[model samples]
Target: MFSESMGRITGLVPSRFLTLLAHLVIVVTIFWTRDINVQASLPPDFTSEEYEEEDLNVLPASTEVILVIAVFVLKKKSF
Candidate 1:
């Protein structure tokens, strides 16, 4: 019984690792392409100075908080 339980727990490791890796890659990709995203979202006439003044960090920070809460809720339910 103990071995069976351990086996089930161990089976989750690879999937969890891959999930973590995928999330990291996605976060990195979003940050890497952020400038392009900002330009696309703003008016074409927007100046560099205006872009420099934009508060772009808020969305990512809130998204991270939401993701963490969601993961915790899902983990609690799964166990």
Candidate 2:
């Protein structure tokens, strides 16, 4: 009874083992040779400095809006 059960399960072990081996070989071969890119890219440089002469003025250069007109009209100076 034991032999009959074992034979039914693994009767043709050679063909089954050969099929599994072939599939493993195919997977390993496919993973071995594939697309491989090992290069890098670089960035560009773009900068200019031509308005350095007018860097000093009586008015403040940090602010862009015209607050002098609104503030002077609403209130007067403390001094």
Candidate 3:
């Protein structure tokens, strides 16, 4: 069913050639519109001391509780 559409093309271009043409067009478009003068900047007064450490010790305990509950549910369903 999928091959039926392949026969309708008026051009004799192979699928590989068409794919290459698409890639060439994409590359040309990217190079044609790319800005070369952009500069990166950081905010004023930014420091590592301003960032607080995140607490992640409670996540494993909650995940273990959820997994234990899930195992009990699966065991109940299988029996």
lDDT by residue (tens digit), candidate 1, 1-79: 2247454565466677688767766776766677777777779899887786553543664477568657756775442
Using TM-score as the measure, name the better of candidate 2 and candidate 3: 2
Off by over 4 Å in 2: 1-11, 36-79
In terms of lDDT, the best-performing candidate is 1
**TM-score per candidate, in order?**
0.56, 0.32, 0.30
* Poorly placed runs, candidate 3 (over 4 Å): 1-13, 36-79
By TM-score, who's the top model here? 1
Note the residue pairs that clash in candidate 1: none
Q: For candidate 2, write residues 11-79 as lDDT tens digits.
A: 455676577566555544433332111011112332222122222221242231234334436656432
Q: What is the lDDT of residue 7 in candidate 1?
A: 48
lDDT scores of the candidates, listed in order: 0.66, 0.37, 0.42
Error of 1 at 13 (Å): 1.3
RMSD of each: 5.6, 33.3, 18.1
